[model samples]
Target: MKKLLLVLAALLVAACAHAPAQSAKEAGAKTERNFSPAHVKEVIVKGKTTQKEILAKIGTPNSVKRRSLGVTTGPAEVWNYWTAPPLNDVAKGGLQPVTSLAVVFDDNGVVQDYAAADSSVLIQ
Candidate 1:
């Protein structure tokens, strides 16, 4: 009976210790950040940059997603960057100043296209 009680206690401790680290890692995966348009433009080059280059230029991604394209179009990847602080409005949520940039890459891992909105891109 004492041995059985000891085993049960060990199991309880193991379960409690196992899950919190995984949850914490998931929580840190998404980042609400202010990215600079100039910095992005300087590092990103269409038909030239690769995934490794991107990681070298920018730090960890807020998140990463995989996408599949049809056979003819070829698979593509998209990365998102925000040029302003993340906002959570209590009421009347509206855009005051925000910038978003997306970089697309073909299966070759070369930058294929990019798009940016807002005057933030005008910054040098």
Candidate 2:
């Protein structure tokens, strides 16, 4: 009986250790609004997009900011999105993951530049 119990416990531990990590897709499926990393990457890396195009593609940004009213500067737009950390690290006290997508547009409303920032330490 002791040996059988030990074997079952070992198997349970091994099974959990080898389980696949939960991705953002799995967690976000339960929410009303969810944007995957791939979706965010597509817009930021693609060329010459507009505000309407962005909204149609990635939904509304989490937040938006405009340049100072009087300052003469190129018009720009920024978008922010966040995802929960993978399950493997959540129990280990990992930081909640976030992704920021910034799309800068010229005064004429043409995509001038774009950037994506991730909270993963490995990315930096």
Candidate 3:
């Protein structure tokens, strides 16, 4: 029984070794989505856009958090939508592209500020 298990494990490893590697474009495709940073920014208007508008344009966020903006501003709500490389790809080493959007809203539920980032390009 032990020998049979060992043979099966060895075969599995051999198969994996012969598997073709994923192309760079294929890796990026894994993280790419319908919406992008520019799309999010276009849909959102700081101090003008409301939470409902954001939901209508971009759909639900991946996460929501509440925190203090400053001593004067008190608290605010933040919505984040993130698309990052898979953990398995990162585990293999090297930088992986990440695209995300964060929207901050005041107590009135109107967008106060927003930022988007894409790590596909490196700045000089």
The local lDDT score (0 to 100) that residue 31 gets in candidate 3 is: 42
lDDT (Cα, 0-100) at 49 in candidate 3: 96
Q: For each candidate in turn, give its C-alpha RMSD to the true structure in angstroms.
A: 15.4, 14.0, 13.7
Candidate 2, 8-104: lDDT as tens digits: 5545644544424557985465334335456656654445677777765665555556667787775655544434444344434434565656666
Deviating ranges (above 4 Å) for candidate 2: 1-41, 44-47, 84-92, 121-124
Per-residue lDDT for 20-51 in model 3, tens only? 45679855555434347778767887789999
| Candidate rank order under lDDT | 3, 1, 2
Ranking of all predicted structures according to TM-score, beginning with the best and ending with the worst? 3, 1, 2
lDDT of 1 by residue, 45-96 (tens): 8889897887556644444445744444744677765433222221223434
How many steric clashes between backbone atoms does each model show?
A: 0, 0, 0
TM per candidate: 0.50, 0.49, 0.56
Quote model 2's TM-score: 0.49
